[model samples]
Target: MGLKWTDSLEIALDLIEEHPDVDPKQLHFPQLMQWVIALERFDDDPKHCGERILEAIQLCWMDEAD
Candidate 1:
């Protein structure tokens, strides 16, 4: 199944894979949201996203990064 807004960890993993050099902690929410939407397997309405969701994804990404 394609990824939804709730799939924060999966999305974080994918983001790291797709942009290995990026620092997840430094990403702005708008850019992060765009990148998430650009993920090949992502499948969700952009309207479903919010600051909290973005923060969750960022936290997951940071955890994976560390």
Candidate 2:
């Protein structure tokens, strides 16, 4: 199975690799969602996304960057 929405660390790692120049702190949810969907390993339902999940992804991404 592909990565799910709950795979925050994996997703964050992917985001970090894909967007090396992007600062997660400046990222907005819509763009973040789009980016996540664009990931080759991502296969989660779009409707499952929410503010809390996005926040978790953002936090994980930030941690990965640091």
Task: Please list the residue runs of candidate 2 whose C-alpha ends up more than 4 Å from where it truly belongs after superposition.
Answer: none
Which numbered prediction scores highest in lDDT against the true structure?
1
Residues 1-66, candidate 1: write the lDDT tens digits: 899999999999999999999998789999999999999999999999999999999999999999
> Quick one: best TM-score, which candidate?
1
Candidate 1 segments exceeding 4 Å error: none
Minimal lDDT window, size 10, model 2: 57-66
Backbone clashes in candidate 2 total: 0
lDDT of 1: 0.97
Candidate lDDT scores, in order, read 0.97, 0.95
Return the TM-score for each candidate structure.
Answer: 0.98, 0.97
lDDT of 2 by residue, 1-66 (tens): 899999999999999989999999999999999999999999999999999999999999998899
Clash pairs, candidate 2, are: none
